[model samples]
Target: MDKKNIKKVVLAYSGGLDTSIIIPWLKENYNNCEVIAVAADVGQGSGELEGLEEKAKKTGASKLYIADLKKQFVEDYIWETLKADAVYENKYLLGTSFARPLIAKRLVEIAQAEGADAICHGCTGKGNDQVRFELSIKAFAPNMPIIAPWREWNIQSRDEEIDYAEAHNIPLKITRETNYSKDKNLWHLSHEGLDLEDPANEPQYNKPGFLELGVSPEQAPDKPTYVTIHFEKGVPVSLDGQKLCAVDLLSQLNKLGGENGVGLADIVENRLVGMKSRGVYETPGGTILYHAHNKLEEICLDKDTYHYKQGIGEKFAELVYDGKWFTPLREALSAFVDSTQGTVTGDVKLKLYKGNIIDAGVTSPYSLYDEEIATFSADDVYDQSDADGFINLFGLPLKVQALKKLKLGK
Candidate 1:
C-alpha cells in the first residue's frame, strides 16, 4: 500500500482490459515507478498474443516478456492432473484452475530475473484465480510483494473498467455490449456474464462467440464419429494410430470432439472465495482424454488399488483446485498416481454423437482380466470346490453373532 517505498514492479499482464489499465495505474500510484509486463502464452490463441508486445508498451509498460508456455502447460500441468483423475466436484476438469500457477510461476521468474521490488496481478478479489496466482507466487517466492489492483483500487465493475480503458486510451479485444469474460487455452474455453448471470436462464449457445470450441448437441451431425486414442504410462501418446506432439494431439481431438458435441458443461461451482459462480466451459479434448484414460485404468488396475485410487483422485482435485500445486502433498500424491499407472498402457475407442461418449472398444496388453478364470462355463482355472472353505471363514463372524443371539433370545 506504501507507494513511496516501492520502486520497480513486475506485472502478470494478459493484454486484457484489467491488465492494460493496471500498468498505468501502478505508475500513477507508485511514484511513477517502472512496470515490466510478463505475459505467459499458455496457448490461449494466436490472436490474443498477436500485438501483445506492442500493446503492453503502448499501455505504459517499460517492456513485455512473453513466455511461451504452451507445451509445458499441456505436458506438465494438464497431464499430471489427468493421471490423478482429478475432476473438481465430479464435473470441472479444472481448466483455469491449473493454468494460473503456470502463469504465476513465470511471473515470479521474471520478477526475480529483473530484481523488481514487487509483483502485480490483474486478478479481482472475488474470483478463484486471485488465490491461484497469489498462492503460487508465495510458494515460489515467499518474500515477494504482490500488488493486486482489484483489491486496492477504486474500480468496482467491468463497465467502469471499460470506461477507464476508454479514458486512458487503452485498446481492448472487447467492447461494452459484446464483452463477456472469457479464458481460453489449449485445454478449454470458459465463458461467463451476460445472460449467464441468472441460473434460471438457458444458455444461448447458438449466439455468436457463445460456443467457441464447438456446436451444441442439438446442432451436431446425425451420424456418429469414432476416435481411437493410445496411451503409454497413463499419458496419451497418439490419436487414431497417428503419433503427434502433445499440443497437436489435443488440437486434433478438439477439432474432432467439437464437431460431435463432445464436451460442454454449465456448472455453478463453489469458488474458493466462498461464493458460487456459474460458467459455461467447453473442454472438447479434455473430455475425450479423461474417458480414454479412465477406461484404460479399468483393465490395468487391480480392484483394491483401483477402488482406493478413486478417493485419492478427489483429494488430488481439491489440492489442485485450491492452488496447492507446489505443495509436497501434491508431489507425494502424484508419486502414488504414477506408481499405479505403470501398467496403464492401452487404446480406448469411443463413439461421439450428440454429446454421448459411448464406448466402442478398449484394449490393453497388461490387462488383468482372464476369460478362463472369470467365465461361468466349465474351466480348470477356477475350481468350484475351492470356494467352500473360503466362504466359511468369510462368514464366520456373522454366523457366530446369529447363534449367540439365538441362545440369548428374550
Candidate 2:
C-alpha cells in the first residue's frame, strides 16, 4: 500500500488523549491525508460528546462524525448477549470487548459511504481490542487497509501519548497519575490500568479516579431495595411495569443499582491474547439484565433444554470474547440462543443492595415449576412410590459399583 495513494482515512476516535493525538499523527504520517474522526455514542454519556466536533477541529481532524448508537447498541448487542447469559470467565460482563465490534462495524459503514481509502483506530498491539477491531474489519471489508498507529509509532506508553498530546496542543483532560483507566456505556463501565495492573494489590475504592458509578459498598445503604424488570421475548421493555426504550431502561437501572452500590466487580480475567489482567467493572444495567434474564429462563426453559443451553452460553461467551461475533459459529450459536429464548417472556423481581443481586420472585407463562408436585405434603400431582423406580434407574451405575465392592470384600 503506497502512502501517496491514501487520500483520506476514517478513525474510530474517542476524543480521548490517544485518539485526539491520532488525528494529527495520521495526517502527519499518511502524506497529510484528510482525517475524518468518527465517534460512536454507545451511551458512554452526552457529557463526553459535548463540544466533540469543536474538539476534533481544534485537534486538527478535518471533520467529526458522531453517531448516536445508544439504542441500537443496547437492543442489538447488549440484549443479544443478555439472551445468551454470556459472561466471560464466569464474571466479566465484557463491556469493553463487546463495544469494539459494533464500533468497527460502524467505522466500516462510514468508511465505505464516504469512500475513504483506509480506516484507523487507537488500540495498541498488545490489547484484545486490536484483535476485535481488526477482525471486525476483516469480517466486513477485508480489502480496506487498517492503520494501527500504536503498533507502528514510537509512542510507547500513555505518558508518551500525554506528552505528544501536550506538544501538539491536543487539550487532554486526563493526567498520568490517575488511578484507573475507564470505559463506560449503557451496558457497563470498566476500570483498568494503575494499581489494577498489579494482581497482588487490591483496587482502592476511595480514590477519586477509582470511583464513578456510586459510593463504595461499605458506604451503601444498609437495607435492601427491590426493583422489578419486565422482559418481552428476552428484551428488557420496562422497569417496575412502565414501558421504556432500551436506553431509558438501562439508564433507570444504572441509577437504581448505583444508588445501592451494586454492579461492582474485581476480576483477574484471561485476556484474548492469553495474558491475565486485573480489572474493576461497574455494570449496573448489565448486572440486572443478566440476572433477570437468567431468572426468566429458569421459569421458561425445560430441564434438558436449560442444561444444554447453559453449555452453549459458555461457548457463546468465548466466541464473543475472541472477536468471532461476525463468524458463522457465532451465528449458529445465536440461532440456538434465539430458539431457547422463544418462551423466555416474563418479569423478574430482584433486591439490590451493597453489590449483591438477590432473588425476589420470577414469573412466566411458560414456567416449569409446579408447586403441587414439589410440595412436601403432596397429592396426586406426584406419587411417592414413583421415586423408587426413578432412583433405581437414575442411580443404577452407582448401585452396581457398590454391590461389586461388597462382593469383593466378602
State which candidate has the highest lDDT: 1
TM-score, structure 2 vs. true: 0.96
TM of each candidate vs. truth: 0.96, 0.96
Please give, for residues 261-298, the per-residue lDDT of candidate 1 as tens digits: 88899999999989999999999999999988999999
In model 2, which runs have C-alpha deviations exceeding 4 angstroms? 400-410
Worst 10 residues of 2 by lDDT: 206-215
TM-score for model 1?
0.96
Candidate 2 has an lDDT of 0.86
Candidate models: Cα lDDT each: 0.91, 0.86
